[model samples]
Target: MPHRPNTPCRHPGCANLVPYGQQYCETHKLLHPEALRSAGSRGYGSRWQRESKAYLRAHPLCAECARQGKYTKATVVDHIKPHRGDPALFWDRANWQPLCKPCHDKKTWNEDKNPVYSY
Candidate 1:
């Protein structure tokens, strides 16, 4: 008769043993599938959205509209280029633009779908 070797769970503070290649214990392994995805991925949800909002508030003036001496209260942050195929651009401040609500929505419809509303 052959015996299988015991493997410890990978979860922090967990002492229970699990099968090889299993990181967490059975109880902890029931994590949501969405939770397994990287935050950098699109449609990963609100965490990334919140971070973008904070960035926008930090720079609450429209960069484009401001350049023309127009003071548009920035309630949204937009990506100059689309972030669909390039998720890395999401956090690039160089690609960010502040715009008022109406202008932001208009740009969102006319431009890329990567505009993150912060209002």
Candidate 2:
């Protein structure tokens, strides 16, 4: 079997090369334990894959982009409310919305970094 070429570490400004199938080299990898987690553990197993695909097919346009009058195609099915390991919330289709990659990333960053709580 042919061997795959090593790829650069995904960490920004890091030119270090890592073996194929690995996202970050050893040093940077420690900084992102969440990325190192398995997809199944992150609630992105076969079920989520299937459901998210169907959702994207049904809601092809990004919700955030639509608000801004841009018709971008949604590639991610994001939960409007953070599931936070709650099985019920994770599987709730009503809490889901279609978002493009940029919108999803921005939303995730904001929520993860600066969460708002209703108390």
Candidate 3:
């Protein structure tokens, strides 16, 4: 098979080509680190849990699953974009979507270093 054409990485000053299906090359991704933290960190505190749970309660079906004609029950509320501990993005209702555990895990798999739930 012929090789797929590569695209330039979006990060400034970087000439690396991003692999297919990825936004940034692995090196650039590491350079622009995510604001990751353990569960008990300030950004992942109790208030977030309550708010996320309320979001899920208000929208109790997986958005992705619904697109595929499956009315799966949502167990999690996800950020449409990676918040990376940004309060503005994390709390934005417009950025939130209801997702079943499986859908949530799949959506976040590439964004984060580890899966929220194992398959």
Q: For residues 1-119, write the lDDT of model 1, one tens digit per residue.
A: 76676788654556999776556676756542323456555543687588668878798888768878998778777777756546578667788777878777777666422333333
Where is model 2 poorest over a 10-residue stretch in terms of lDDT? 110-119
Off by over 4 Å in 2: 1-36, 116-119
Q: What's the TM-score of every candidate structure? A: 0.50, 0.66, 0.62
Query: Residue 106 CA error for candidate 1 (Å)?
Result: 2.4
Flag clash pairs in model 2. none
| Lowest-sum lDDT 10-residue window in model 3 | 110-119
Q: How many backbone clashes does candidate 3 have?
A: 0
Instruction: Give me the runs in candidate 3 sitting further than 4 Å from their true place.
Output: 1-36, 113-119
Assess the local accuracy of residue 4 in candidate 2 as a C-alpha lDDT between 0 and 100: 100
lDDT of 2 by residue, 16-52 (tens): 9999999889997766666778879988999999999
Q: What is the lDDT of residue 72 in candidate 1?
A: 79
